[model samples]
Target chain A: DAGITQSPRHKVTETGTPVTLRCHQTENHRYMYWYRQDPGHGLRLIHYSYGVKDTDKGEVSDGYSVSRSKTEDFLLTLESATSSQTSVYFCAITQLLAGGRNEQFFGPGTRLTVL
Target chain B: DQQVKQNSPSLSVQEGRISILNCDYTNSMFDYFLWYKKYPAEGPTFLISISSIKDKNEDGRFTVFLNKSAKHLSLHIVPSQPGDSAVYFCAARIFGASGTYKYIFGTGTRLKVLA
Candidate 1:
């Protein structure tokens, strides 16, 4: 909700197919993160970018890839979509709050279903 | 293995009453902890946080208490309202080898404040 938007609020894809979710921000923040939320698992980071053209893997990076070519956009791509990858994806940007600590603000979310 | 764990799956509390959410972490290296609140179809929002140096932190209606010896933290909401009904997730940060901090989240506990 903090100047962040994620495209395709709801998406349905088939297994073995590829899916890419887009995250765009107007804040021009330096950090962007991709995460997935499942029923049992809260939210697991898929990838994060510290700056443009710079990215790093998270705990659950398998079957997922990320690209950040521009300062305002970060993309998450599932090379081969699987049922296990079906979850609500969220994009977040980090900023330093008044408390002098970094806090993350998230986009609404994109619900991806793989059948 | 889950480094951060929230044992309660769900909790129901009446309006104007108090609600308590608990979280535990296994990683001793984690010195900072945060609490996030998520509504349906929305992204998780930062709530309150406590550092290892402080045993408690309070912000208006929400309070976070930390116990270093027990490696546990609890969120307390006084006079819980229906609007407060949502899922809460606990997160922990561990310094990564890449010089960037990585956050690990718990499974989450759904809170339903009855009107």
Candidate 2:
């Protein structure tokens, strides 16, 4: 297992409230990603960071945002929690070897519920 | 439109039987494919992978076959065990493009191994 941890493994918030999920990794990996898993949707990328202060939006980035101010931390925030945003969120870090085989290691996950 | 699709939402297999999971993709640019397994309450973990250059790759009890002409891939688990019961996701990555290493995942198929 990777030395990755997600804060507040479980959270429940109300609609229109702001919620932030934090992902911290002991490994100084250069690539970090955030994904949400929902029924019939498997895992969808929410946002990802390639380096400190460098982030990009994914296919489902409409309702989410991410930031990576340091090498070991990546944060995902929901500006206003919605019922549709309730799901299991996972943080992952990618390690690329010289052969270009990029393997991703995942955190346990964070379960968020919006009422 | 979903670039990757896992048509079968679930599958069941008896212990010591062969389990087959299928996946299809619509993007021609996707050249690398991978399979990941996930148990409830945990994040997905990499299982096996096959590059587009090769049609097949095997690791122990797991084998991945790719059909580029059909734009499909399948994962076969021989002599399935109860421990193998989990949700399987098919993912792909497009190369030759900057920042395209992000994976596109299928909805996933839940596999159950009955003892």
Candidate 3:
């Protein structure tokens, strides 16, 4: 909850529909990450951005896309939502500190349900 | 395949007792490990982290022990408090080809501190 906020705290959507989740940070951190949490899968990173316009895939990048247009905003878009994607989504921000310490701060989270 | 695994799905410990949560990783390239605590409806917050070069790291009543040879890590909380009851996640960081680190998280262990 450190200076991070996720939009649409809860959402109910239909399968095959497109959905976009927003993450805003006031901390001005350089790195932002999108993750999904499920019952058996703790938290799987979907994508992360190191800087504006610089994004990369994560372990579970399939069926998800991300964009960072500004330093404070990172967006995660589900091009075609699926029932398998129904999970709690979280956004986290982090800055590289001295000695290579990277501690991420997370938003409250967005619960998305795909029917 | 899951690189990080937390076999225990839930754990309960009495107040003033020690609670130990364990995690194992299959990847040897991981350079750092971290612990995060999550509440019912909130995003995860960073609790502690340890570099691969270190065997143990401690802060206040929480201590993390890493065994590189066994590919195991454990978090120990002394005098567990009700406030400490939550889902604990274990994550491992590996350096990516893009010069950034990617994190892989375990399924998580839910800890309940009985009052």
Candidate 4:
């Protein structure tokens, strides 16, 4: 809770609808990540950005897209919602240090349900 | 295939006792590992981390041990409290060529401390 906030704590939408979830952070960290958590599966990274305008896909990037236009904001979008995409989404940030250690901070999370 | 795995879905421990949670990874390139705790409807909070350079790292009641040869790690919480009851996740990161990094997480282990 140190400065990260996720919008729309809970959402319900129909399949095939486009949905977007927003994650905002006040820490101004350099790295931001989007992840989804589901039963029997740990949190899987959906997308991540290293810097503004620099974004990349993660292990489960299908149907998901992310944009980081600024240091404090990272947006995750689903072009077409599906029941399988119903899960808890989390946003995380990390600051790289000269040393090898980097600690990540997470947001409260947004729960999405596709009907 | 899952790069990170947490076989135990849940663990129970008596208050003031020790609780151990295990995690395994299939990726050999991973050099950093971390543990996080999450409560109901909340995002994961950073707990502890260990690098391949060290086999163990401890902070107060929590200790993390890494076994690189076995690609395994475990978290030990001494004097487990009811407040410690939550889901724990293990994560790994591999640094990419361009100074970018990505995390892979295990499913998670729900820990219950019975008073």
User: Measured with DockQ on alpha carbons, how good is candidate 4?
Assistant: 0.86
Clashing pairs in 1: none
Those runs of model 4 whose alpha carbons end farther than 4 Å from true positions after fitting are B96-99
Candidate 2 lDDT tens digits, A27-105: 8999888999999898998888889998887779998988899999999999999999999999999877665566788
- Model 1, runs deviating above 4 Å: A98-100
For model 1, what is the error of residue A10's alpha carbon versus the real structure, in angstroms, after optimal superposition?
Answer: 1.3
Query: For each candidate, what is the lDDT?
Result: 0.92, 0.91, 0.93, 0.93
Q: State the lDDT at A94 in candidate 1.
A: 81
- Residues A1-115 of candidate 1 have per-residue lDDT tens digits of 6799999899999999999999999988998999999889889999998899888899899999999999999999999999999899999998856754667889999999999
List, residue by residue over B29-113, the lDDT tens digit for candidate 4: 9989999999988899999998888999999999999999999999999989999999999999987555689999999999999
Name the runs in model 2 displaced over 4 angstroms: B95-100
* Model 4: residue A115 alpha-carbon error in angstroms: 0.7
lDDT of 3 by residue, A4-69 (tens): 999989999999999999999997888899999999889999999989999999989999999998
In candidate 3, position B58 carries an lDDT of 99
Error of 2 at B9 (Å): 0.6
Query: Each candidate's root-mean-square deviation in Å?
Result: 1.3, 1.4, 1.0, 1.2
Of models 1 and 2, which has the larger DockQ? 1
TM-score of 4: 0.96
**Candidate 3 chain A: 10-residue stretch with minimal lDDT:** A93-102
Query: Residue A71 lDDT in model 2?
Result: 95
Q: Which ten residues in a row have the lowest lDDT in candidate 1 chain B?
A: B93-102
True contacts kept of each: 0.82, 0.72, 0.82, 0.90
